[model samples]
Target chain A: MTKPLSPGATIGILGGGQLGRMLSVAASRLGLHVHIYEPAANPPASETADRITTAPYEDHDALTAFAKDCDVITYEFENIPTEALDLLEQHRPIRPCREALRISQDRLTEKGWLADLGLQVAPFADIKDAASLDTALERIGAPAILKTRRFGYDGKGQARINAPEDAADALASLNGAPAILEGFVSFTREISVIAARGLDGRVACFDPGENVHREGILRTTTVPATIPHSLATDAVLMASRILTALDYVGVMGVELFVTDTGLVVNEIAPRVHNSGHWTQNGCQIDQFEQHIRAVAGWPLGDGKRHSDVEMENLIGEDMDRLAQIAAEPGAALHLYGKAETRPGRKMGHVNRLR
Target chain B: MTKPLSPGATIGILGGGQLGRMLSVAASRLGLHVHIYEPAANPPASETADRITTAPYEDHDALTAFAKDCDVITYEFENIPTEALDLLEQHRPIRPCREALRISQDRLTEKGWLADLGLQVAPFADIKDAASLDTALERIGAPAILKTRRFGYDGKGQARINAPEDAADALASLNGAPAILEGFVSFTREISVIAARGLDGRVACFDPGENVHREGILRTTTVPATIPHSLATDAVLMASRILTALDYVGVMGVELFVTDTGLVVNEIAPRVHNSGHWTQNGCQIDQFEQHIRAVAGWPLGDGKRHSDVEMENLIGEDMDRLAQIAAEPGAALHLYGKAETRPGRKMGHVNRLR
Candidate 1:
């Protein structure tokens, strides 16, 4: 059996946003040190981390130095460049290995992997150009999403093709980048299963949380999602299958579309997720701490929820409600120490337990 | 209403140990920065804090600079010297005020304050010298505890005077420090109420927790303490009385002895107490966050416990159980990140929720 990482051991984190900020806080609680590597001058995680390497992901020298100091390298976001991972992996062990990220980084690859596991996904086809888009749209039909295969977040890098004539404009909009056309699925609601898998292959999943999005940014997630019991079970099972297929370690959030027929795989996050934020107030162990434990080779903690909870993200001007949230009797208000509240930026969040 | 402390506002913290570390974590969660002034290098709070000023409590220049940058000053431990408080308060707001610290720092003063509140306390008398010790021993009787009035913690600076002849020797051993001789209370169990008071004079208290001590150090604290409802109510009332009398703005813990007669106040901590650690798992807001909210001039959070919990401190060699503790299914482990764990040092703690 692998020895558990000691408290003073450093965990290297990529992408130092609020997720990294929270991960750093959770790591510190476990007596572990964190080294955050981000391009931003004032990444949220840097405030709480023991060390910060303010360098681009392409900087091999800095990445090497960071990797050499860290006992294990993990990431806050899945969009990290493959070259960065290859460089860091040379010096230290990286959890949720390169294979997992490779499969999860692109829409086509993620859907392909999910289909291979006998899980149902929204119908999709690869599109390279106008001609290919025409052919793909012929197969998937109208009202399909044309999304770039990589580097797209918060609804960026995507367009909708409503007709064959519109397909050409959509292809041109991506600037000739590789893209995929996905058939939209009519879903009753969207839900996600946030779970952790330990080195010993033990998986623990929190109950699925129903999610609502605003402009592709998560607005709120309410736990004990109002889905059929069988559908919830199916969502959790699909998540476990993905974890096992990737041989993944650490927490992975599996977002699913709960349709009238059944659950359809949406995408997988390779780290602690926004949907799981309710665990901070609802469960005994939160996703951040669970992710830390998984990478540390410690046993997985119980992910049982003691209360039904709702987590709301405070974006930009939403932070103005901090005082009102704090005044709420059963609300747990959490504000990240970001110096500025840019439009659409996640300034903080509040978890209310009932 | 007062303006909310902004993101760049600096919070001054005294006694930089694990409690201070957790407090800094909570403060950063609210976008408020912290500057920890501690005597030791690499104090636990320093790892995550924005700045660390390492200097002895007597360093006037360092204290002045620390106070000047902070919007408000608060402490993690109650044992800080009164002179240090006087110096810091000159430049910034000091929550819980100097009067609370003065009454809590000495046993005689604390007892006098409690008695003035019309509260029940063990029969006690002041002892100054051999003659005074002899007189107090006769008044308080044998099998009593003779404790130095100042600077005593975790069984230090005190001796058990089980017989009349031991009084003179015990008094001499303390080198004539002001002392308090008190008859022992035969109690069924020990319990403590951890509560917070906001600047608006609102009080919120968590359910009282039963505590067990070994060698004068807290061993474990279990919530939903096996006590009668009336007894727990009395404990909360006692804590409320103390907070009101002191005009306390931050969290304070009141330890009580449940005896045949009723509840007797054992002692009061002017800062967060170890027994309150269970709230991290059992409540929506832990004591650390509640303390930060109170000192930041924000409203106090809900201090209600959601489940029963047991918290055990990882003192010194007990840290060796990190693996087992981390593996415990429902346990939430918190390590202080201290570099060294000498005998009796509190390395971390674990909370198990039911």
Candidate 2:
């Protein structure tokens, strides 16, 4: 892994969702071929990847074959099966490392690791059972969120505990899974920094994007987030510190809460995040390509934003208005090739250049 | 034909060279699949295309199957065999239409057609043999080019005549192929306009690019081409006139010779042109996506460019410098995934944003 991969090398991606689809496309831009591994039939990445293995992660043969074909392996989602990653790592190098995955996969591990690094994070308590849940809620406070320590995304696996009376119902939402109570942080806004570290340990960070959420799902991310010059510099510094501490290689999205005192890290995704989608139109190298460059052992791009952009995600039924969005002036539409339009599925996104 | 193609519809592309490879990537961004028809095995487009038919154009069955799967058919090059096009047209709509192909396939027809349209083409003469070549040289004078009427590109299939004595060698170089002698025009610089027309006949044109050639092969294209404001306007108007006249339903590259006399029509390519590669990083809608939008019956983008960019072609051994180029700040590299490097063969391109 000391030398960068040559053109025509194959990158194995685990997960064929929109992020994988985009990662595949970005790999193609660099003359790299992508082989996608996903259990779903005709996943979105299938349309863009050079090859796709539609087999469950539990299938050892498929995972081995995918790893054998790739020079490097990466994943779009952090919660990949530990056994599968264990097998693939034996065949080829898995980027961002298993350490990043182990930490980011669970809220408790990520919070504790960040706190150890002297990075401010939300106050939290781990709860393993009903008795522990009540004790954690009392310590964290009534106005808090009880979330499963693992496999939670887009507001799923969490319930609000507005008061002590609501604790039982919030715990019910977890359905006996181990949870963590995270006390709310009073911040002016949410912002995310898409940062990447190359094999040589050099880190590059895109301008943080101000995020707006609807129903707990990311709705829009605007680049050049409205903030003071010092805070913006602090936000990028915080991301670089994390990338350096983790010895990370690949793009990571660091979600931060902008408080009056300083920036508080809300969460970290070990792969490309929807908040960085504006980079597709605003910068020379995008988050997807940055991730590919990192995993492929290529030199990192100097992440510089050339234009202000606002990226809006097209959630499920938002696709019904595809024609309208396509015809809108200054709209660059990117749609995921999904056959079904369920209520919460991410259909695609559009970046409007300003 | 009136309705725009929906997400997930397939676009059948003829030729799987670098142009087709890029076209496939662009179609994917719009949620469309690409099926490439190529005679060569393991073409560059194979990495990005959803499907590829590795059969020669002579195979009507393969052509038929490809067309049957695609909602619309478009080509990356103009010289597709007539019989193959004839068979594919019966199954699905072929865009840019047969008229554009007919006019651009031969030097004689293109020159005559442009002249007939009252466009300012260079002085030229038709040569069917050595005798005709002699007659044409007498009329057009020395300092002309003798080119094969069909299949000429990248300075191939043509010979230069610096003086009347050079005429015989020029004609001999054609090997009795029907030829045309184009008299040299005294132009300050070469510029090209990338324009597109939708199914409804609406036309949109990107800014003209100034081209620099090395040994008659395009080496670089810089947008915001050095030219008077009025001439730039005139260039777009001229391109719009041609797309309108042919009822063209895809993107076209109109090369113009900018002179003291004004812009002279040099040549026209009926597909995405290499000169338009700058748009990939400069504009919201690039030439490939614009071409896809045209043939797919979607509305054309505004064709606005937000950045000034210079696009350099990676030809032959230029690829050996990949690592150096990849590390350059503000440089966006696009490799065609071509395995072998041959002299004059396009391997990829790099767009540098300014």
lDDT of 1 at B247: 87
Regions of candidate 2 where Cα sits further than 4 Å from its true position: none
Residue B354 CA displacement from its true place in model 2, Å: 1.9
Which digits, one per residue and each the tens of the lDDT, describe model 1 over residues A32-145?
A: 999999988988888899999999989999999999889998999998888888888888889977888898889999899899999989999988777887888888889999
Query: By DockQ thresholds, what CAPRI class is model 2?
Result: high
Which docking band does candidate 1 fall into? medium
Tell me which residue pairs clash in candidate 2.
none
What candidate 1 gets wrong by more than 4 Å, as runs, is none
- The C-alpha RMSD in Å for every predicted model, in order, reads 1.5, 1.0
Candidate 1 C-alpha error for residue B153, in Å: 1.0
DockQ of each model against the real complex? Answer: 0.78, 0.84
Model 2: what is its DockQ? 0.84
| Cα deviation of B158, candidate 1, in Å | 1.1
